[model samples]
Target: MSLLKKFATVASGTLMSRIFGFTREMLMAAFLGTGPVADAFNTAFRFPNTFRRLFAEGAFNAAFVPLFAKEIEQNGMDGAKRFSEEVFGVLFTILLGLTIAMELSMPFLVSTVIAPGFTSDPVKFENTVNLAMIMFPYLACMSLAAMMGGMLNSLHKYFAAAIAPVFLNFILIGALLLAWAQNYDPLQIGYALSWGVMAAGVVQLAIVWFAVRRAGIKIGFRRPKLTPNVRRLLVLALPAAITGGITQINLLINTNIASGSAGAVSSLVYADRFYQLPLGVVGIAVATVLLPELSRALRGGHMQEAGNLQNRSVEFTLFLTLPAAAALLVFSEPLVRLLFERGQFGPESTLIVSQILAVYGLGLPAFVLIKAFIPGFFAREDTRTPMIFAGISVVVNVTLALILFPRLGPTGIATAEITAGWVNAILLLSVLIWRKHWDYDAGLIRRIPRLIIAAAIMAAALYFSAQYFETYLSRQAGLLVQATTLGLLVIGSMIVYFATVFAIGGASLSALKGNMRRRKKAAATPENTDISA
Candidate 1:
């Protein structure tokens, strides 16, 4: 399949997941609000999520996919199966051990690392520790699932792994409904959601496991052993783990700093859910498809193909991400208010969350660009370079958050985050160009400015449209009225953005369709293997 088709496959799944995610967030806002229970639950969920990203998705995808793809190329599916079983035994054992240790130390972790500020209120602290213990085991399920997902992605079965996350949102939404139906208190609702998270992890893992099996790769459990393959995976994964979780690490810092203020942690989490929609769809789809594709190309000594892949990935990433960033920047308040400003999530909550959402908007492109650029290094087995850059970004985040939080509050933490994001993204791209590993194809260079200009025009249009609809967006307006106005703003902005992009030559539907046509033709004729867009 063509790159665009592959991206669409993954993105379609992600967009569904994000839509459900928004629904889940809206429910949480109405039920839990930005209360003590909400803060504690958000902290608990973030803890396990941070570790899952660090140890599972980012780490394994970076270290395992390339090696697995190479094994398929060099040693066939049989060799790849053996290698996967070996890594699974070791990964399972490690995850089991880590989950046990974390559960045992849950209280200390909640007090020190997860949310020190919660210690001031014993109720919040105890709730966090309990909730975290219930949810921490999710890391084990997800890590195992991530290994299977890496296997599926390497085998070109993208839809299953991509669709697995939707189950998470679906299950969580069910939990919220149950809580609401039962008329549970905030604490009881938090408990339901925590258990829901744990259950979702198992369901997600099972979905991917079945996918890997259907892909004709059945991995059996074996005694844990440190074979050459497992050892090499560990060597690469350790650093990649750090590099992969850079965004979560920075957000953890933001959460910790924000925890000192009541409702701050919940506020940051809400705002984060807004920006994550685009980042997950565009950035993740590009990264997931690009890494394995690039790795196989490089392994086959297709240097020009590798460069083209990198250039096109960047172009595609910006084409989607630029307008997303523009929408978030221009309509943060209306979007937040329309979706979340009901029930306990009042105007005050909307104001704070919108402010933070706007700051995150500025960094959305940088965030997606990092996803696009890091694969260049990972496909080449250069994990340490990105790890070093991630370390620098972390330091920048921590320092700036500490310096600014006293004055600007949670918004300051958001500022620190974006500043660090731009820093890491610039460093990654600079090193890629400096090493001649990535070349800015003239097409990419030309289209970038056009994309930016198109996004700017769209943002200006959205700004005016929001002004015209201000009365309907106010707090006094009914929910249906507010939602209708916001929907129109979104639809009109999308129309303007796409029209501008196509008009200014930022993108080409004909070129995209032709590229796909060529890919399909190449697939039919095995001898015609060149499928460049």
Candidate 2:
């Protein structure tokens, strides 16, 4: 299948999952709002969620897919299956041990590291620690799921893995509804939600596991051994894991800073959810498909093909990212209100969340671009350089956060993150260019200006449109009215943005349509090999 089509599939699924995730968070807002229990739940949830994202989307995929793809290309299906089983065995064992350790230490972690501010309120601290322990098993399930997902993506079977995340939100929604039906207290609801997270992890893993088996590959467990391939994978994955986990690490740093303020952790969580929808859909979809494709291209010595892919990937990223970023920056308050400001989620929560969301918007494009660039290094198994760059970004993020938090509050934390994102993106791009691994093409140079222009135009329109809807947003308008007004604003902005892009000759309707279509020839696979692989 074409990379464009594969990306669409992954993005489409992610779009669905994010929509479900949106609904799930909306329900949580109604069920708990930014109350102490909500704060506790979000705080406890952050640790597992951070590492899960890295394992599922970043670190594991980076190190595993390229090597897994190479195994298939060289040694065929049998070799690939054997390698996968061995990797799974080792990964599962490690995940189990880690889960146990985290569960044992979650209380200490919550008190000292994860949510130190909650400690001042003994109830909040105790609840967070308890909730965190309940969800700790999710780490194991997600780690195994990541292994399965990497294998599926490497084989070009993206649907099941892509859709697995929906289960997490769906299960949480069900749990919340059930809790409401039972009139469970907020703390009870929090525990229910935590268990729901663990359940979803198992469900996610099972679906992908069956999908792999259905594809005629049976993954079985064996005694963990340090086979040469496993050792090599660990060597590559350890640093890649750390590099790929920069987002989580930065969040941890920001969480440390945000934890000093009551409700700040939950505030960042809710605000980030809005932008993560776009990030997951556009940036992650492209990155998921790009990694294996780049690995194959580079392994076969097709630099031209690899370079062209990188350029198109960047173009695709900016085209979607710019509009989303503009909307977040311009319409963040209304969007936050339209979606979240109901029940116990009052105006104060809306305002604070919107501020963070806007700051987050400033770095949205950088976030997507970083995802686009990282594959160049990972495709060549060069994880350590990105690790160095990530370390620098972390230092920058933490230093800035410490300096700004006292003055600006949670907005300051968001600001540090955006700055760090840009730093990481710039460093990654410079190294890629210096190493002759990547450079911008004319297509990129021409297209980016138009994107910026389109986004600027959209931002102005959205700002004005938001003013029109301000009364509906603020005066406790009914859900339908708010939905309609927000919907119109969104639809109108999109129309203007695309029209501007097309008129400026920044994008081609025909080329985009054609790119979405399947070509008559199948993409070339890596040359079959006889090496042990």
Candidate 3:
């Protein structure tokens, strides 16, 4: 399959998952609002969720896929299977031990690391501890699932792993519905949701596990041992894990600092979820597909192919990401109000969340670009450099967040995050260009400014459109009227953006079609990895 086609497959799945996730958040807003229970639930889930991103999504794949691809190239399927089993054995044992230790230390972790501010409120603190302990085991399941997902991606069977995450939202949404039906209190609902998260992890893991089996790699557990291969994976993964988890790391920082204010954590969480829609769909899909493809190209000594992959991925990233960022920046308040300003989520909450979402929107491009760039280093087995850059970004985030939070509150923390994000992205891109690892073709250089212009035009249109539809989007309007008006505004803005983009040569139908179409000759020749064909 062509690279663009692979991206679409993964993106479609991610989009589905994000839609379900959006629904889940809306339900949570109605049920818990930005209350103590909401804060506790978000905090509980954040621990496992952060580690899941750190290990399963980014770190494990950065280290494993290249080596696994190399194993296939040099030693064939048998060698790949053996390598996978070795890593699995060690990973499972470590995750088991880590979960046990974390469970035992849950109270201390909640008080010190997770949310120190909650300590003053003994009930909230204890609830957080209990919820975290129930949910922390999710990390083990997801880490194992991520390993299987890496295998599926390496084998070029992308859909299964891509679709696996949808289950998390599905299970959580079901739990929310049950709570609403039974009319559970906030604390009871929090427990139900935490248990739902734990269940989702198992379901997600099972989905990928079966997918890997169907793909003909049955990864079995053996006694844990640190063989050379496993040892090397560890070395590479430790830093990659940290680098991969940079967003969550920043969030953790924000959480610790923002936790001092009531409703601050929940506000940030809502805003983060809104921006994550674009980031997850575009950024993650690119990273997931780009890493393996780039790794294989570099491994096969196809420098031109590697360079083309990077340039095209950036083009793709900006093409989708820029406009989403524009929309968020221009229409944040209406969007927030439309999505969440019902029930307990009031106008005050909407205003605060919108402010934070707008700030996050400014960083959206940088956030997605990081996904596009980091694979350049990981593809070449250079993890430490990105890890170092991640550390610098963390420092920037910590310093700025501390300075700004006192004055700006949640928005201040968001400003620091975006600043940190841009720093990390610029540093990664600069190193790639300086080292001659990334090649910028004329198409990317030319289209970037045009893409920016196209997005600017769309943002202007959205700004006015929101004003024109102000009455319908206001609280006086019924939910149906607000939803319908918002949908039209979004659809209309998208039409304007795409028309302007294609007309201005920012994006081309012919080029996208050509990239999506598989060439007969390239398909006949297995060694030809030229993505442009």
Candidate 4:
């Protein structure tokens, strides 16, 4: 398939998941609000999620996908299957052992590192620890699921893994509904969500396991053993675990810092959800496709094609992310209030979340661009470079968080993150440029400024729309009225953004549609047998 088609497939599935995610968040806001329960739940969820990203999705995929893809591209099906099963066996064993240890030590960890601030309040501290223990086993399920997902994505089976997150959103939404229906208190609602998280992981694992089976790979339990391939995989993965985890590390820091304030962690989580909508749909989808595709291209000695794919991935990422950043920056308040203000989430909650959302907006493009650029290193099977840069970014983040959190509150946490994002992105781009791995294509270079200009124009339009609709949005209107006003602002801004992009020559309608046409041609092309350089 063409790169664009692959991207579209992944993106379409992510779009479904993101839509469901929005519904999930909307329900959460209603049920939890910006209260102690909300803070506790977010803290608990962040613990496993941090490790899930650190070891499972981020590091494992960066190292695993390229090697697995090469195996498939060269040695064919059986070779790939053996490699996968071995990795799967090792991953499962490790996760099981780690989950047990963490569960046992949950209290001390929570009291010391995870949420020290909660300790002064016994209720919050106990709730956070209990909720985290219930949810922590989810890391085991999701870690295996993430490996299965990488396997699926390597095989171009994007739908199953992409849609697995939808199951999570649905499960949590159901849990929230059950809590409401039972007239459960905030603490009980936290329990519901915690159980829902573990259940969702099991479901997600099953979905992708079935997908890998249908794709002609069946992996079963085996005694853990580090064969040569497994050892090599671990070697490549260790640095990547740290490299891919910088963002999450920053988030963990922010969570700890936010814990000092009552509802600050919840505020950060809510704002992050909105930012991730665009980041997931565009940046992550692009990154997922780019890994296997670029690995294949590079292995086949298609340097020109490799360069073309990288450039286009960046173009595509920014094409969507730039406008998204603009929308969030301008319409954060209205969107937050419209989506979340109906229940216990009052104007104060809306104000806090919206402020963080706008600050996160400043970092949206950088976030996506990092997603685009990191593959340049990963696809080359060179993770050490990114690890160094990640280390630098981490230092920048921790320092800034320490300096800012005391003064600016949760907004300071958001600021630290964006500043660190730019630091990571700049370092990545500089390394790629310095190594001559990514030379800016004239076409891409010419379009970036135009894209920025178009975004500026769109931002101005959104500002005016938000100003005009401010009074209506601020009133104690019903959900329907607020949603309608917010929808108009969104729809209008999208129209203006796309129109301005086309007018300014940032992207062409024809080039995008041409990708659709070329998809067929790409499928017909002979497979390149050169799978190793």
Candidate 5:
């Protein structure tokens, strides 16, 4: 598939998932607000989620997909299948034990490890523990799902894995509505959301399993053994886990500090959700599609092709992520208000969440760049270097959060996160250059200034459009009007940004247009011909 087509396949599904995720969060805010109930729920959810990112997104996929892709390239389908089964067996055993232990020690884990937010209130603390126990098993389910997703991604089947997240968001939305209809207590609703998470995990696992079968890859449990391939996977995955762990520790530190501040944790969660929409859509989509492809190119010694792919991935990521960052900075308030300002969510909550979103927006590009760049290292099986940079970034994040949280509250935490992201991105690039692993070609160098110019135009256009449209988005306005005004601001900004880019020679309209045409043509071609070349 063409790069653009692969990107579209991943981006389209991710965009849908993000939209549903937004809807789910909106319903959650309406029902729970940023009150103690919201606090407990967000806290409980983050516990399993932090680990989910560590194991599922961070450790497993980072180490697994590239290795799996290599096995397929070197040994054939059966070799790859055996590798997957061995890893799956080991993962199942480990996750089962971890889940049981975590569930049994739920109270202590909630009060100490996860949410120090509950320390001030006994009832809130207990509710958080209860919800966490109910949710901890989700970690196991999602871990397996992520493993399945890694397999699908290695097989170049991006759509199913990308769409799996939408099911999760939809399940949560359903649970929220059901809770509302039943007039469940706020804490009860939180538990229902927890159950929804588990359900989503099951759905995602099923989807990917079916996709794998269709791809003619049969995966099954086998006798657990530390075979050579499994041992190699463990060795590589350990550093990834540590790297992921360091990053999670930074978040946990912020969470701990936010815990000390009333409602700060929930505010950060809401703000993060807004930023994650773009991060998920652009950053994650690129990482998901690029990693396996990069792995194959590198293992096959196709350095030039790998470099070209890397450059294109960076260009594409900037094309999408820059506009998203601009929009978030421009319309943080309206976006927050339109989506979350109802029921228990009040004006104060909106202001706080919007502030956090703006702060996160400032670092959105850096975050996306990290996603695009890290695959360069991971595909080459170089986890230790990224781990070192991650450690440094964590220190930056933790220290800044500690120094700023006392002064600016949750917004300070958000600012610290952005700063840390930039720090990490710079460090990664510096090391890559130092090692001569990655260097921008003349074309990439030429494109940088043009991209920056385009991004600046986008920022200016979005800012003014948002200012102009705010009056039409009054607090008492109907939801339709509020949504329409928000849409107009976004659409107008996009038109202005594109027009400015085309006028100023900051972007190539014809090149992009032609790329799309090529992708459509390629997609229409026979599958055998598509792969043979």
Candidate 6:
């Protein structure tokens, strides 16, 4: 497939997932609100999610996909299939054991690792522990699901893997609605959401498993064997694991600090959900499609193609992310109030969450750029470079958090996160340029100024629109008015951004139209056999 079509496939699936995720978070905010129950649930959810990203999304995929793609390139499909089984066997055993141990030690983890913010409050601390224990095993299911996702991506079947997360949100939303229907306590709704997380993992695993099988790869449990391929995968995975873990360590820090403040963890979580919608849609979709393509291109010694792919990925990410960042900055309050002001979530909670959302907005483009840039390194099987950069980002985040958190509270943590993201992105781009590993073409360079101009125009429009809407939205209005106003702002911002991009020649309508035509032709071409340099 052409890069554009491949990106489209991934982006479409991601869009669906993001929509459902937004729905799920909206229900969660209404049902549980930003209070003790929400705090406990957020803390509990972060535990497994943090590790899941570290292992499944970051370490495992960064290592697994390129190796798997190379195996398919070097030794044919059968050889790659066998290698996947061996790796899956070992991964399954290790993740299962880790999950059990984590679940068993939930109390100590909560007290020492997760809920330091609630140190003085025994009730919140205990609830976080209990909820975390119930949710801990979600890591295993998600880890396995990620493995299956890697395999499917290698086969160029991106839809199933990308859409699998939508199932997760669907199940969680259903669980929350069920709790509401039963008239259960809000805390009970939180518990249901936790269990729903595990259940969603199961459903996601099943979806990917079926997709793998449909692609003619059957995965099953086998006696764990340390095949050469499996050994190599483990070796490659180490740096990625360390890198992903370090990159996410700020979350751990934030959680630790949030423990001391009532509802801080939950407020961060709500804001994070908003940030993640765009990140997951654009950043992750691009990363997912880019890695395998870059890996294949590099292996085939197609340097120019690899460079072009990286450049386009960056452009596409910026195209979507810039407006998203602006929307968050201008509409954070209305967005938060619209989705979360009903039920138990009150105006005070909306204000706090919006503050964090705006702070996170400052970092959105950087975060998306990181997702695009890091794969350029990973595709060359150079995990160490990204690891070094991630380590630097960690230090920056920790230093900033330590300096600011005492005086600024949860917003300080948000500031620290955005600053770290900028540091990482700048370092990544600089290193890539200095090392001559990636470069943009004349077209890409010429269009950047236009893109910036377009973004400026959109930002102005959104700012004025948001200011105008705030007065009407600030009243004791119903959810419909808030939702409607926020929706209009988002729609207006997007329209203005895209129209300006086209008008200013940042991205012409004809150019994009031509891209679609080319994509169809590229997809019709057969796979090449000579993938080796």
lDDT of 4 by residue, 1-533 (tens): 66777788889888888888889888889888989999999999999999998898887779999989988988898999899888988988888899999999999989888889899999999999999999998888888888889988888888888888889899999998898899999889999999999999999999998999999998877678999989989988988888777788889888887788899999999999999899899987988898888888888888877887888888888888999998889889888888888677888999999999999999999999998999999999899999998888888888998899899999998999999999999999999999999956787888888888999899999898778867777746667787788888788888998888888789888666656554434322212211001
| Residue-wise C-alpha lDDT for candidate 5, range 1-533, written one tens digit per residue | 67666778988999999999889999999999998988888888888888888887788778999889988988899899989999999999989999998888888877787776677799989888888887778888888888888888898889988898899998999999899899998878988998888888788888888888898888889878899988888888877766645445667778877988778888998988889888888888888888888888788777867777777778778767787887788778988988999999999999999999988889999988988888888898988888888888888998998899899999999888889889989998888788877856665566666667877787887777666666778788778999888887777778876776567655566566545544433222122111110
Ranking by lDDT: 1, 3, 4, 2, 6, 5
For all predicted structures, in order, the TM-scores are 0.97, 0.97, 0.98, 0.97, 0.95, 0.95
> Once all C-alphas are superposed, what RMSD does model 6 give against the true structure?
3.5
- CA-only RMSD, every prediction: 2.2, 4.1, 2.0, 3.3, 3.4, 3.5
Alpha-carbon lDDT, every model: 0.91, 0.86, 0.90, 0.86, 0.82, 0.82
lDDT of 3: 0.90
Please give the TM-score that candidate 5 achieves against the real structure. Answer: 0.95
- The per-candidate count of clashes, in order, stands at 0, 0, 0, 0, 0, 3
| Backbone clashes in model 4, listed as residue pairs | none
Of 4 and 6, the candidate ranking higher by TM-score: 4
Candidates 2 and 5 compared: the better one by TM-score is 2
Query: What are the clashing pairs of model 3?
Result: none
Model 2 spans with C-alpha error above 4 angstroms = 523-533
Which pairs of residues clash in candidate 5, taking residues 3 or more apart in a chain or in different chains?
none
**Clashes in model 2: which pairs?**
none
Q: Write the per-residue lDDT of candidate 6 for residues 1-533, one digit (tens) a residue.
A: 56666778888998898888889888888877877888888888898988988888888779999999998998898888888889888998899889888988888888888887675778777888888888888889899889889888888899999999999888988998899899989778878888888888888988999999999988767789998888888877878876656546778778887677777888888888899888888888888998888888888887867887888788778777887887788778888887778877888988888999999988999998998998888888889988888888988998998788888888999999899999999998999999999876776677777777888788899888877777657646665776677778778888999888887777656545545554433222112110101
lDDT of 3 by residue, 455-487 (tens): 999999999989988999998998889999999
Candidate 6 regions exceeding 4 Å error are 245-247, 518-533
Please give, for residues 281-387, the per-residue lDDT of candidate 1 as tens digits: 99999999999988988887888778878888888888889999998998999999889988889989999999999999999999999999999999999999999
Error of 3 at 159 (Å): 0.7
So what's the TM-score on candidate 6? 0.95
